[model samples]
Target: MKLTSLGIRQKAFAYSMTTLGSSLINSLFSFYYVKLFLNRYRISEGMFHQAQIVFMLWNAFNDPLFGYLQDNAKVPCCAKRHLSILYGAPFYAIAFLLPWFPWRDYQEGDWLCGVQLVIALCAYDGMLTFVLLAQCALFAEISTKHENRLQLIKYNQVASLVGSSSVLFCGLISDNMENIFNFQVFALCVAMLAFGCMYYTGMNCVSQYEHVEKLEKDKMEDASNLSWTSVFYLTKQIVTQKNFLLFIVMNFFQVFHLAFLNNFMLIFADHLIPPYLLPAFVKSIMYGAGFICPQLLILSSQSLLRKLGYYKIILSVFYAELLSATVMLVLGPSHHYVLSMFLVANMVMVSATFSLFNLPLADIIDADLLNYKRSFPLSSMVFGTNALFTKPAQSLAPMLVVTILNQFDYEKLKDNFTHSEQSALQDLHGAMFYLVCLTPICIAVLQILAWTPYSIRDSHTDVAKYIES
Candidate 1:
């Protein structure tokens, strides 16, 4: 299909609206949920652990289930990617609002608080997986050209710059999460705004190329005849692929690193930095920079990405992170200014690299289709299976971090910040410094090991050869 300049711009805008919506809601949840539950609500460690366990199971299960349903469904809303988003976006928005309001008046150590955490996480994740699987599937279906994908990324990142500011906006309006009423009000507004963006995208975005239509028709015919054994076999083929294994292994660590940062950056900032050294506004800017600078970096690095390719760029990012984290660890948190600068820069690089993940993922999907000689792309299935392995990290990161921090009397520190003993504060700061520095160092190392043998670089060439044949 030939797209005019106007058509391209319109497509880009429509596609970007999904990112705007997803990023806003996901950022709000990721940045604040752990803090809200553990710190604000005073959820017991045991209860918190129980919630993560339940969330992990649900998170792992939903991805492939949603993906399979979307790919195989007969309904127009499910079969057509954009329509799925249009219809599911409202439910997704409502799920986003779940955690902001307490279901009951609960005292400290209340199991009800943990129940709320579980419900909020599972509900939000289920809807998010459904909506985003469609969006991701649409991404692969919408364009096959490398340049076109980059163009989409450029536009999406621009949208993300705006969407990611939800955290900053929340920080301002909620008085950095001290004001509960204001935060709930912000959540309501965000839910409405996010719904609007997803609804617009679903209504406008198009993924109806002739080949895609043919593939869907073929897939529908195949689905009618599919059985339990064949379904299991197809899944085996997908999960056992070498590229998929490598990507998911690497991706798990990346997800963990991102979760670690998103969920705990505010906590880290508050503990590690002296109040006199960094004012609230400046810290807010730094927090906001974590979201904004990454997009700007990705935008500027489009040329570099093309030149180096995904593998090299990603490997280099890991090395940079490893080096930066190591230096920060050596310098210690006492060098407040230097530590703060490195922290923000490292967060930006991680976020920027993570943003490019979908490009390589698309390549993997293309490779899979070529390898299997399938008529239609199992784009959502591939994305979902990948998530099946990696989404657990989202739960695990917070659980493990909180577990570690608890050893340093973290709960006590939070409860009595103003009246905490100096000795206890010193120990907590030491733990925080090590946690921030060492976690990234370990993740970067593991990512490097996992990603080194990834072979999807040749997928584009394979596509060209397939086309020629």
Candidate 2:
């Protein structure tokens, strides 16, 4: 299915909000508020970690429930794609603000910390889960073609970068508390901007009308007659194929690594250098490069992957991550933070490398259909489906970071960085270091290992034959 020039432009616009908006909102909170909960607020590290863990434990049930709801419910034309984002935008924004609202004025209480943590726990886990999962899945449900899916994700990321960059750039101008630069004002502004775009995109982006040949299927109810038979059929179908199992595992790790890295970046930036604007500047500079480079790389690589194939791209991204981690581990703190040259270079390279490889995850669904004869209505269940595993990575990385900071007592984070911040960070430095460095390397190694048997060079199209036969 070739895209018209206009079609491509519309497609890009359709997914941009999710791409841009998700990155902006997710990155800001991941770094600051999560840190605030641990550092300045003096929340118990165990309690913080426990709160996060409980958050994930709840989502274990909740993610699937949301997915089931998304899959089962019949959304009308516009509502089909946009409702979740529309409904969620305000809730997510406010959920973020809630912890701050209570924490700022009511800093002391008979159970001040306890009350704050409970509010945050509910905001992040319960309310957040619905919005995050629904919004991520919206990207997939909007399109089905492999090429279109690539464009969708590409622009989605563009929106993500714009949203994130605006935040970092604004961080440069205003104190978040005072809104000197009108930062929260702007976050709200874009919430309107992107949510409006989300709705508009869903309205005009793609042709909703398509016809299908109906195939008879049994009722989901009638457990005795239908449940066992359906279960056996799916099991036999799945067991007959070896690759599907492998695909699921690798896809799981892919989501885990992506989420893990995103969660780690904020805290890592905060400590490795100065806080707020400085780190945001360095991050923006790096991500700015990332924003441009990977898109060009992926678009151009259409020719390369045609000749060189997708496996090479996957291997390259894995190796790049491995190399970046090693550099970070070796460089430690030798470089200048003021210039942030070291950090910026590390970021540009790591981010570009991740972006370059990002396409294959989309292609994997393509690869799967080609390899194993499974055709997903939306490739999202393959892509964002890992939202289940990685959402916890969101909570899990912080839990680990806080625990280490508490354990190490922030020895490295002490006077070398700042006397005041030392206790806050020192209180939790060990946790941060392991989370920022060690966990990433471990995740990369696992990704590389997964890629080993994931070879599809020869049989990338095995599923096509099944369709033909």
Candidate 3:
């Protein structure tokens, strides 16, 4: 079963199609779901809160479970990473469409709406977990060389530029989400496009070394003999590792910051920027920039990524974010243009930084393999465990922001209408400013603290040495 040989560039492109597919659907869901359910559909805050609770609980269980299954299962599709994608992509696409359709017409406080939200979130998350766990596992399995992984990242960000444009495209077709039917039509098109990309990637991309590894019957037998006790021990070992602990702590805050911005950026733009000052089209472009510019920034930063390394680059981004947030806070929200620019820029930086997380994570996986003297990579388990800790931040971010906004009479602004009362607008604006600015300041400080002690020095050297052996 020799796989087709591909040059590095070809492999990178093929591999990155997974990113293109995943990001297309995921960015749409992450950025728009909160607004759609809470505002457009007019679901109550209490119901939204209940859905998040269910989502958080489900999110925690699924990541590690899927990771363990993918890594350990004897099923052919589960054993082969790309095959998993081929089988799972269609289901993932279907899940992406879940929230777009309401199962029933419902009045306010109807438990059916809450049920729909819960099912939408959990279904999408479950499928997403299965597909992406395979994609991420393929990332480590594809190559161990630092240079090779960076190539994959470069191609991925490029793909992300296209995939992430689903948001921009949706904005254009839906007239900034004012038309429900248009948005629904746009989503169906996106789901089809995403499935094609993922399916193509699965069929085309193959790990260069996997065929050789498959020849090792003894290792396969050993993997078959893996048991629950071994799984528990491995989980314990991973969780107890000091560097893994530090990384997840920092990542939790990073996820929280990203979730906050992605979920509510539109709401922020609608409320903070008056329509007369900045046209809806201009705001649409800005919203689109939040998705697109991050890739461009990361693409431009390749030299920095190579020279400074992940730790330094990440810390620099965090500190820069902290400083920028502080400055924005001091300046206040009086200037709508400045506020809008800051919000978009903040999302760009955060999104870009988040994109590079897999690099360090790959390093950690390499370190774990070495430390445990393991024959095979535990990439899925490591990523899944990390998600176990970080995914909750996704649910928590919306809940916290909504709770705070509710305190400031945010319910009254759900229609996204320009308020007539200047006094109420002023109060909501102040609250929004603090949420946008203060959150990063606090998160940056915490991330800096957590990340500073991370001791995975010289990932390139470590990974290169590991691969050569």
Candidate 4:
């Protein structure tokens, strides 16, 4: 039996604590960590992108092994899912901030480049792979009921909003890093304050029967410690499903669109805002919009999914992202009040897109269980695949922005162009439109195409067929 009202509340709090805790620290890393590494180390733009590509390749290498082990790996007393989170949490926390602080400074040439590469391996590859992949796979263990699983996602998302929106606290810390906080001192505080406390919080979840079943299946799969060869065999079996394979392809394209829009925003602020403070303020305004947008979007999602269907919702969100991109481009480095309207629209649309996109994952999961006569753990699939595609967008998007930046040679600014320096505004415009609108447009079409042939919904009628076979 599931927990009662108070019991569920308590468990929710515990899970929320872990979600909020890690998200809080990760949020700090996201907003300030890039500026810290870029400015403090004076790393070249071209090189940074290349490093990200290398990190993606590392994921390609490790995740099949991870997905396999996570699938077939078992725990003695506790659930394997919970065990994965607990054991990896410490390593995850450590590697997360590894890039935030370098052991020592490197010379800014051949030697420095080599050192940077090592740090990327130690920091980006290590932390992201462990924490994200583990936590995402950890979702499968949240609840066995389909609706309950989706509710768990809601709780996780709320924590995400809290964590991400509260990033200003860290921004202030970064500004004061030299004068008061210092480097390791600040890192220690956040690490202890966030991850340490959250680790304790995650321990409170009461195990359920589904968790027990997973453990038993894992034990049946392999009698000893998980080996690399075993994981590959499991993956080969899992991906043979046409529906699952198509979903993966669709996910890659749409998520690539998301990654593109997300990573390229820096270019907008860089090109548009003449005053540094103003740009940040503009960006910060969007955070507030992002904070509330998801909740509001979810209100209509159920009805929408019931009516026009999930696929249509996905396509609509894609168009919304595109509209957001187009509005920003027309507004361009010019600060008309109208621009803010476009921006708020952009935020709402992208925020809503995430909410809309979430409903289908569980639906697909259910479809998988109903059709395949076996369970596929999807937690790893979501985040692990995301990290895979993210490498290309993170590296390439910035490079695209930087190439535009190279247009500004201070000496010839007035003579070469019409009024003032070009400020790479056109590049920013092209990037935003391409990422949010154009890319998603293509992916959205592909997603529709990929899913059209698969009739898992219709297969719901085949319940007796699988049993009778």
lDDT of 4 by residue, 362-450 (tens): 44544445554553444454444434443444445444544544454312331222365345534444444344334444555666676
Taking the tens digit of each residue's C-alpha lDDT, what string does model 1 give over 51-74? 999999999999988888787777
**Model 2, span 290-371: residue lDDT tens:** 3344444555556555456566767676677677767666765534353244334434444444553434444444455555
User: Which is the better candidate, 2 or 4, if ranked by TM-score?
Assistant: 4
Off by over 4 Å in 1: 209-213, 458-469
RMSD of each: 1.9, 5.6, 2.1, 5.5
Q: Rate the local accuracy (lDDT) of all candidates.
A: 0.86, 0.50, 0.87, 0.51
- The CA lDDT at 93 in model 3 is 98
By TM-score, how accurate is candidate 2?
Answer: 0.73
Which rank order by TM-score, best down to worst?
1, 3, 4, 2
TM-score attained by model 1: 0.96
Supply candidate 4's per-residue lDDT for 32. Answer: 50
lDDT of 3 by residue, 1-469 (tens): 2222356678788889989999899989998999888876778899999999999999999999999887777786876788888999999999999998887876767788899999999999998999888888878877777777888899999999999888888888888778989999999989999999999888988654355655335446766888889889889999999999999999999999999999999998888888899887888888889999999999998887777788998999999999999999999888788998899999999999999999888888888988888777888899999999999999999999999998888888666446457787778878998988999999999999999999876775443635432
Query: What TM-score do all the candidates reach, one by one?
Result: 0.96, 0.73, 0.96, 0.75
| Number of clashes recorded per candidate | 0, 14, 0, 3
Give me the displacement of residue 449 in model 4, in angstroms.
5.4
**Which segments of model 4 are wrong by more than 4 Å?**
2-10, 74-79, 105-110, 117-125, 172-188, 206-230, 276-283, 287-312, 327-348, 355-359, 375-469
